[model samples]
Target chain A: EPEVTQTPSHQVTQMGQEVILRCVPISNHLYFYWYRQILGQKVEFLVSFYNNEISEKSEIFDDQFSVERPDGSNFTLKIRSTKLEDSAMYFCATSQGVYNSPLHFGNGTRLTVT
Target chain B: GENVGLHLPTLSVQEGDNSIINCAYSNSASDYFIWYKQESGKGPQFIIDIRSNMDKRQGQRVTVLLNKTVKHLSLQIAATQPGDSAVYFCAESPSGGSQGNLIFGKGTKLSVKP
Candidate 1:
């Protein structure tokens, strides 16, 4: 079974700095998504990417957040200025098709903003 | 087993028992629903999903029941084993919206003891 792979399994960054979380989605999958879970909170949707553009984003995906599929296989989430609240485990998921198709997730990148 | 600091609602069950974790979704327009299992230090793993047209769907050791009338979902695990201990989450995705943009509920931690 092909799986999503994330880079820098864990990151520790200083507040006010920037960090980019990388994900390599399944080769044949088309749609990609980014979600985050604060230490004790529910997993929250941040953004969805398809066709090399952002399809939709949540309120949490504000000015500081941006997603880019720089290459055919890599999907990256960049936070311009990290805040303490931004510390969370970020997950990348991809799906073969939209409706009812299973979303394959990566092991997640733990971002610790201090 | 491992434990996460999320302090989620927990259900303790003995091995070989049936465990059901419930969720109430906030979106009535969501046509796709999924259940995910997350162990400590790992990402959410797909378990099963149910579509709007169907009320029930089953997988290897799990079943998902959807009640659109009340916007509710439940994941039932049969003959639970100690390895089944993990946090379970239910996510919803609207049909007409961006395809895989999901909204997840707070997870319920299920612990199985021998």
Candidate 2:
């Protein structure tokens, strides 16, 4: 069973500072996604990537947020300026790019903006 | 304005008892649905999934039911154990040529007594 792995289990940053979270999805998976869960809130979809480009994104993924597969195995999300409202657990997931395929998720990176 | 939502916020069941969590989706075009379990401080783990074409699917001790007419989804856990205590979310995807985004429901916290 393959798994997605994320780095920096917990992150604390000052408001307006830049931050980058990294994730390594299961090998051989073709689709990747980023989602966020605010405290006591539902998991919200932020963006989905496939074939090295963003296939779709939610309104929450504004100009401040960007994603890149810097390398073959690493997917990274960068926030140019962290805001207080950005405090949440960010999860990275991957799937086989087929309908109804399960999305395997990483443990998550908790970002706390001060 | 499609949304996924749960009927309850929390549930408690004795060890060895069965547990059920329910959700509703407003999207008539949704093609797939999944249930995820998240322990505190972790990302969601996929439990089970069902497609609109199927009414029931079972895996291990868990079962998922999809009722498309009323836009309802449910997860059933038999002989719930302490490890089953977690927050559960039902997610839907309108993947029939859609960009493949998942809408997650407000989670329901399930607590299994020892």
Candidate 3:
């Protein structure tokens, strides 16, 4: 079974610095998503991408956040200026389709902003 | 506002006992639902999923029951084992959105005691 791979399983960044989380999705997947879970909180949706464009995004995906599939393979999430509130486990998910398909998730990157 | 939530925060059961976790959703129009399991340092892994057209679906040792009438969902694990200990989350697609825009519940932590 293929799996979505994320880099730097743990990341620690200082406040006001930039950070970019990377994910290598399954080669055949067409849809990609980013979700984050704060300590002892529910997972929250941040953004979704398809066909080289952002399909939908949540209010939490503010102007400071951006996503790109720059090489048509690797998906990345960039935060312009990290804040303490940004500390959480960031997960990258991919699916072959959008409707009934289950999203396959990566192990996740734990980002800690201080 | 759309909200998906679990009824319990934690459940403890004997290794050989069965476990049942419950979830409630406020969106009646949600047609797709999924149950995911997350271990300590991993992302959510798909356990089972059901569509509005089905009332119950079963896999290896897991069963998912959907009660659309009451807007509820449940996951039952038979002969629970220590390996089954994890946080389980139920998620649903927003009423007017695709599955990529899943809204996850608060999650229920299951603990199996040997």
Candidate 4:
């Protein structure tokens, strides 16, 4: 089966620094999403993108957070200024853009802000 | 407001035994639900999903039950194996459309004792 692939399995960055997480969804998938999971907490939805634009976003997605499909097949999440609380696993997922379709998730990028 | 939660944070089962994980959601409008298994340091992997119109759905060795009236969902794994040990999460699509953006629950860690 096709899988979403994320770069930089683990990233360590200083507080207030910038970090960009990259992901490549399956070739035919049309919808993309970003989710965050704190060390031992529930996963939280950050944002969703379709048609090269954000379709919906959660309150957790604030000004400091941004997502872009720089080019076809590449989805990226950028944190303008990282904070200690930003330490967590970020997962990228994609779907076939159909009703009730399951989203395929990548292994994830572990980000640690010190 | 949307909330999804697991009844137990951890579950222990013997190999070859059956394991069940339970979840509850506060959003009555949520029509789509999914169960994901997450191994350490990895993203949530899709296991099975069910829509509100259906009361039950089964996969190879996994079954998902959805009760819209009680707003409850459950996943049952038959003949649990050591490989099945992981953190299980139940998620719901608040918008009930395509399940693009999901509201995830605090995971239930399944431990299979061999």
Candidate 5:
């Protein structure tokens, strides 16, 4: 089965520094998404990308957060300035562009903002 | 105010027992629902999904039931094993949004005892 792949399974960044998390979604998948789960908490949607543009984003995806499908297959999430509270497990997922399609998620990138 | 939520934050079951996780959604227009399982350090894995048109769908040892009238969703796992211990989340997507954009519920941690 095809799987989404995220780089740097773990990353530790200093506060106020910029960090870009990279993901390679399934090759044929057209919709990409980013979600985060704080330790022992619920997973929260960050943003969804389709057609090279953001389709939807949650309030948590503020000015400091941005997403890009830099290449046809590489979906990336960049945080302009990391905060201590930004420490969490960031997951990248992808799905076919059909309604009700199930998302395939990557193992996740553990971002530790110190 | 669209939101998906679980009935309980945690559940405990014996290895051979059946485990049921429940969820509720406030969106009457939500037509697609999915259940995902997340182990301690991994991303959410798709377990099962049900559309509003179907009341029940089964896969392997897992089953998903959707009640559109009541805006409820449930996942059932039979003969649970130690590997089944994980946080289970239910997510919903309203029609007309990005096909894969989902609103996740606060997950329920399932503990299976051997």
Candidate 6:
């Protein structure tokens, strides 16, 4: 029943400010990911991380966004300059393998930009 | 771009009844599929998954059926309870892609009433 844990369940920031969302994935998981869900929209893939580097990213994952596995257990997403459109629920997920295995998600961090 | 979509935006079911949600994908290369439940203000929670090689997979009170030829997926919940009310999403991943990188469909909201 291990779960991914996120910090700052809710965050409000001014447009143009910097924000960092943190997540601690399951201990044994080898792959980590970041996804975002805009209100009333489908959850969108942002980036995937494995072996300490980005494995793949979507178009939505632009220069303003970055992800890091800063430690053995911590994975983080940093937005250099938040825009109003950046407001969404950011989710962190992990999986034991790259195929056939289910991804486990965190409760999510709600990012609201004013 | 490939996309995953649900047939309906919302479904209402009486408590103790069975519920079924359907999804369609446009990607023929996708070999893995997963169903997730997202309560309001939360991240997507894994429900069940089926690989292209399997036509069906069951877990607890839920069953997932896959039609690889038609690129269709369905989730069935037996004896649905009020707690089962949530938005259900179907996600797809291409063969040989990172497991954490998933393409999600617009969710179908399920409302269970007593």
The numbered model that scores best in DockQ is 1
**Model 4 — TM-score against the truth?**
0.94
Score chain B of each candidate by TM-score.
Answer: 0.93, 0.89, 0.90, 0.89, 0.91, 0.91
In model 5, the runs with Cα more than 4 Å from the true position are B1-8
Q: Which ten residues in a row have the lowest lDDT in candidate 1 chain A?
A: A96-105
Docking quality of model 3: it rates as: acceptable
User: What local lDDT score does residue B82 receive in model 4, on the 0 to 100 scale?
Assistant: 100
Q: Tens-digit lDDT track for model 5 on A10-86? A: 99999999999999988899899999877756678889988999999989999999998776778999999999999
Model 2, B75-104: lDDT tens digits are 999999999998888999875544448888
lDDT of 4 by residue, B1-114 (tens): 001243447899999999999998879999888999988777889999998889999999999999888899999999999999988989998764434889887778899999
Every model: Cα RMSD to truth: 1.7, 3.5, 3.5, 3.5, 3.7, 3.4
Evaluate model 1 with DockQ and give the value.
0.61
Name the 10 consecutive residues with the lowest summed lDDT in model 5 chain A: A36-45
lDDT of 1 by residue, B22-67 (tens): 9999988888899999988888998988889999998998989999
Error of 6 at A39 (Å): 0.9
Best by lDDT: 3
> What tens-digit string does per-residue lDDT give for candidate 1 at A10-107?
99999999999999999899999998888888888898888999889999999999999886778999999999999889999999874568888899
The alpha-carbon deviation from the true structure for residue B18 of candidate 1, after best TM-score superposition, in angstroms, is: 1.1
True contacts kept of each: 0.68, 0.48, 0.55, 0.59, 0.61, 0.61
Tens digits of per-residue lDDT for model 4, A1-114: 898999989999999999999999999999999998777567888999999989989889999999998878789999999999999889999999888799989999989999
User: B1-109, model 5: which lDDT tens digit per residue?
Assistant: 1012434478999999999999997688888999999876678899998888899999999999998888889999999999999888899998776677788888788
Candidate 4 wrong stretches, greater than 4 Å: B1-8, B96-99
DockQ of each: 0.61, 0.42, 0.44, 0.46, 0.44, 0.47
| Model 1 vs. true fold: TM | 0.95
